[model samples]
Target: MASVSALAQVDATPRVSAAVTMEQARMVDIRSLVPDISQSIAYAGSNNFVGAPIRGYQAPRCWLKHEAAEALARVDAALRERHMRLRVFDCYRPVRAVAHFVRWANDRADQRSKATHYPDLDKSKLLGDYIAPVSGHSRGATVDLTVLRCDAHDVDCEPLDMGTGFDFFGIRAHTDSPEVNAAQRANRHLLRDAMEAQGFRNYAMEWWHYTLRLEPTPDTLYDIPVTAPTDSGRQAEIERLMQPYDGDVPGVSLLVLKDGKVVLSRSYGRSDLERGIEASPATGYRLASVTKQFTAAAILLLAQDGKLAIDDPVKRWLPSLPKVADGITLRNLLDHTSGMLDYEDLMAAPYEGQIRDAGVLALLEKEDRLYFPPGSSFRYSNSGYALLALVAERASGKSFPEYLRTRIFQPLGMRDTLAYVAGGPEVPHRAWGYSKACDGWTRTDQNAYSAVLGDGGIYSNIADMARWAAALDDDRLLGKASRALAFERQAQVSSTPEATWYGFGWRLADGLQWHSGESVGFRNTIVRWPKQRLTVVVLSNRNDPTPYDLAISIGRWFMADAQAEPH
Candidate 1:
């Protein structure tokens, strides 16, 4: 759990006070130390894993201890003599910024940066190797940088291709990975040589990362803000939006996107009732069946890559599946027309602990039957999405989460979303799920099959959902054709006056495309009025009273004249 002080100050930079020690005062801005050095602080922008400006990094300027900055200046001069210069990507990361990384790494569901940074590895594997609670950079002695060719006055230069981009979390980014060509290898050597000559040592796992051998303040971790200060009056809007959730129970984090811009973002109620932790915009809520669209998107992404056809039979990948499933195609699975038995219902009465995606297949194999012929009818089946997840993994040679992270989340910059799994990293600012009890609110965070992904088991917040909503409207991830397939009516699953048509993972009725999720102690709904360029995401941590109604009521605010018939 994050400290209240830390959480409260996340958006604010640390200011120097009279009590500051002389050693702390020695910290100097890198620009003042080396006026000519090029800097591009990734965390200060949306380029980092968090997909937003990191906590404490209010500005893009680099800061470092005086001694370390002087050493870096010397290295820059030496590189300039060789008609090259050092361009710093990151320097003097704050302790708060490192805490933000820890929170992100623990969130199994937030893989938006996995593709660009760690496509081949799971987010859980990044904790010890690529990310840690404590970093040398926080001590003001480490820097992430690349080499750039320069001309007179250091203008009109090109960055040397070092095989992999900075902050890439794979073997290719290693100092000696044997994956890069000779030219890229030489470039890495050149950067390392200059830094090492100035008493810096390269981290073996990252070519662009280096720490001074004799750090100026090895024992100190600064909490200074990275960006200059400013005041924004948006807090009033946030407070107003949170007015309804002014109670002791768990709350909701919401975001409204109109015309690709976030007009509202707010949080309410308690994140952890037992700890008396108030919910904030950072709190993550289990998305439940809201995860279905992501699973469907993964299948679509695989199809786009030509790794597998949507019409390919389920057995094409899962050879062990029973003959009954042979008629089921990947498209059938995406659209919930596979007729596969619900794995949740098949689980034993007492309920086994948590079943993973693999366990879902194993259970399905034991049953040698289908509810209906594949693609002939529509019935929402958690089993179909689970199988789709398997197909995606097999087709892409990556886990379901990894594929979504690399292909969808990262591409769209939805940094705070992920298909969560048990034993994975902790969800930062996590809103503990709760249910109404005779006595009071009771913790009901996980169900018997909470670990099973695909159909559900994702966790996210409204800030990230805004990005996701934007992607659905554009051809950023899926092409125009694929997007059409995702939203097109595939089966008339319901025929009543208040009926819904089923698409890949969305429920279509009139001009509205939406989905709702209900788990042990969470309820969520996301509604997109694409024609109006409006999206409303309501994520609640309480199980009672599903959020679909609230989402519909909110949607009316944006769709008064163009309100579509409701389901």
Candidate 2:
């Protein structure tokens, strides 16, 4: 449900013939405010999600800026002499949404759809073809598009079909696909020509993608939290009924909910621990492996679509899957019982394709051994979760980011949450992760750099995390049975066999649903006790903030308070 592309203009008459200054629209894009003039035009374009160019569309849904609309009006007027008008495919987008596209194209679950969209394409051949982690759209001025008829009275103007559907990844997404008729290709060229005339650059692989030379906003990208529309009651009572994280001291944010109401929240310590910027509920942290729950949610959504079954063997799609490290089920994969080795161990530092999840299988597929029989015992292997990440990719016909965004992140309105990659522009109100030593604090890697896409790579704030906990408690994110199964503790064999417990990336301590993640320079924890409406989360950038001890004490505090509260 995010926009397919970015940088759109409205061919419209400007009221007072005035243009809105970029100074006026400092944060939100100007394209979001006013209408365009050439309303009858439409376009054909391809999306990375489906990996092919799709034809037949309508006018833009989001509006254009007053100046851009006026500029478009001028262009339309000039083109009017030749019976031409601008057509569009997509517009201003959230950069995180582009990450969504990468996730979808990598998914193998819906081969049927791929076959229909790009008949000559291979689902396994996506990375080199359509998907790449970095995106031009993220720059805020690019778009994917094609032209349409402007002559409303000219004998029922026909819509041209592109060679393949939007989101197709093969040669079909190319502008020169033989499958499309010459006229259809000509129309595409016409739109491209118009945009190029306006100084917008087109992407070579995807002819629809274009970036404006003079962008409305150059460097500011807002990390707006996805929020539910607040009713008057909730809005009015929020300040009064809500709790505030008053501890702004140790760079930690805490929120406690009881009987469906927020009871307490405290934040302490500096967010910019060096600059002495105090932490607040808005201080964002890399969710780290807290992302897997959303990845698991994507797989379940695929199950809901009947695209794949949770209990299916991983080898069903990845036929070259190594022999059962144990008698592993997708269930076990979800629960991390598959004895797959942890991929994080293989990389010294993850960045620039160093530790991609897909590469893990290729690495393991060649080995003649299993860490253990798949079901023989359990190990807290990121490798197991990494492979299940592949299952999610294959099953959703989307990248891990897209699957989570569309099915999980967007649905819960965790607006500020993002399965974000690094190297993109820095976001606002975002807390940079830190690694503190005698050398002082240095920015730790972003979640995406860990190459732990499904197992980690999500960045969010305490507020968004709170919403995630609430969503899980409501069971709106997953079915009751799935939720019950996901939270059920797993009995594992380790050095000490009797006390080991884990559950689908969720660990259990005293019947609490919990999980902890660690990597270079950071540690994170989240614990939820649904029966008591209890949730705890601690995200620290330093290699060790003693999170386990802090979580234990916090959990004890909540439990003690529960015992004392009168029913």
Best by TM-score: 1
Q: In candidate 1, residue 523 scores what lDDT?
A: 88
What is the TM-score of each predicted model, taking all chains together?
0.57, 0.52
lDDT per residue as tens, model 2, 238-283: 3212111111112455555555455655444445544334455666
Top lDDT hit? 1
Candidate 1 residues lying further than 4 Å off, grouped into runs, are: 1-244, 561-567
lDDT for each of the candidates? 0.76, 0.55
- Candidate 2 shows a clash count of 46
| Residue 27 lDDT, candidate 1, scale 0-100 | 67
Question: What is residue 205's positional error in candidate 2, in angstroms?
Answer: 62
